[model samples]
Target chain A: MAATSFQRILVALDGSDCSFRALDFACHIAKQYPGCTLVLVHVIDQRALETARMVHLQPMVEEIVRTLHAAGESLLAEAEAVPKRHQVSATTHLEQGIIAQRLLACAKEQGCDLIVIGSHGRTGLQRVLLGSVAHAVAQLAPEMVLIVREGAAASAGA
Target chain B: MLERILVPIDGSPPAAKATTLAIEVATRFKAEVRLVFVVDDSIHVLAEPSYVQPDYTFFADKMREEGEQVLAAAAKRFKDAGVKVTTQLRNGYVPAEIGASVKEFKTTLILMGTHGRTGWDRLVLGSVAQGVLATTDVPILLVRP
Candidate 1:
């Protein structure tokens, strides 16, 4: 058997500290493989904008699109910064729809062999919801999932 | 006497891959392997046709014999590769019996092919792998086909 090669990796970024740590973890793993490809996916959950549509009464649909694009670019920029700290190649994308669905679809489309994601994103809810987007990706995706917990890397480093 | 490992015979290539890995590990570790075939009871379920005459004891026996043949044939691969091996037969859940034998023989580790066989094959045939993994904290390496 050949050494386990992580050829393609998908990193989910939502501009949260946990998401950034996940990106850092992905970069660390990516450097171990000879020709690994890292993909950064920022999901724009359109459902969140539904409530704002009622209050503003204007064309919230267009506003939602603009906000999503801006967030995607910012998230992608943050992801790019981490890979530059190491020696690895990366690609970035902006996805729309249900957060988990879009993230899974992106992995399939990108042909990622593994997915590294935060256990919880902006919402650090540890109760009722056993999993965040990362946990869902781990369960639903055909590939291996690396659910990075907060402070895992730093503690590992220590 | 086994610094090496022995894997029982199942035709599943996925399980075979686990055996191959076991062989490599054994070779590297300088361990001798003994291949054992357990005449697991579930062979009856795997042998019967969907609409056959209900009684399966006779058919199950015949299937057990066939399983022994598979084990014997599988043992040859190791011998040919110049790896040391031995064979044995047992009757029970493949995993439970295998785990018991592993302890009895003082086997180092158990390697298995997870064919994910279910239903009667699963009911009578518990996952030898899962059983070993659960019961004995000893290492179990599962190969996915």
Candidate 2:
């Protein structure tokens, strides 16, 4: 059986509250494994870049990339606190690609044993227009995946 | 109300591990397991010679026979564990057929092994569990082997 006891863990983050909720779950898992490696991955969706490219706007593209870089860095910084608080070690990576594909590719390339991802809690109209990234990654990743729905983890404590 | 579960088996170790985990969870829930196998008609046709034109009926019969043996072995595992066991054989897309059967048999849940066998194999064909998840609303418990 593929190890439920994770040695290498990957958490996909988007700087959303839901993503932070997933990070919390990842931290809990890392605490359990103790020796496990945690990787925080942020994928800058290619669609955002394509929008900038369509308008032939270099300035927009630069601004978007810069904003995304800072967001990725801050997300990782926030995630770093989780592992440190738990006395665990983790590394972070920020990449540009299609969100789901990049997440799956990084997991495979990095030899990650498991993935923890947060569902965007999208429903109704938002779901129909923008498909869930978590859903797509779970479909695409070959490794074990733990899906934490928005508020599900917090509500569980309640 | 199916507190017990049924997982179809094909003798592949990936499927076997899935069956094992299903049995564990079903046992935990105090449920029984029913094993099912579906013979994909395409597999038999692809194996046939176009020049000689092997009889399709006879080929399907052979596939059913093979499926029975696979399910029988799977049934034995659960039966040995003192879990009520049943066997079924069907024909269609594996995931859709499994979903239909889950409803038909009133299965409470479906459990599947995600990776087929090895990492290399999964990186190639994607995953059956992934396909099932996309197709079905039924809650799935995926096991990785």
**Considering every candidate listed, which one attains the maximal TM-score?**
2
- Looking at model 2 chain A, report the run of 10 residues with the lowest lDDT sum: A121-130
User: Which docking band does candidate 1 fall into?
Assistant: incorrect
Evaluate model 1 with DockQ and give the value: 0.05
Q: If you superpose only chain B onto the true chain B, what TM-score does each candidate give?
A: 0.74, 0.79
Task: Candidate 2: list runs displaced more than 4 Å.
Answer: A1-5, A121-131, A154-158, B1-15, B18-112, B115-141
lDDT of 1 by residue, B53-115 (tens): 666677667756876786777677766667777777777777777766775656644556544
Q: Model 2 over residues B11-57: C-alpha lDDT tens digits? A: 67878877776655455456777787877666655557773566566
Best by the DockQ measure: 2
Model 2, A90-109: lDDT tens per residue? 88989899888898999999
Please provide TM-scores, in order, for all candidate models, with all chains considered together: 0.52, 0.56
Model 1 misses residue A69 by how many Å? 1.5
Off by over 4 Å in 1: A54-58, A128-130, A153-158, B1-145
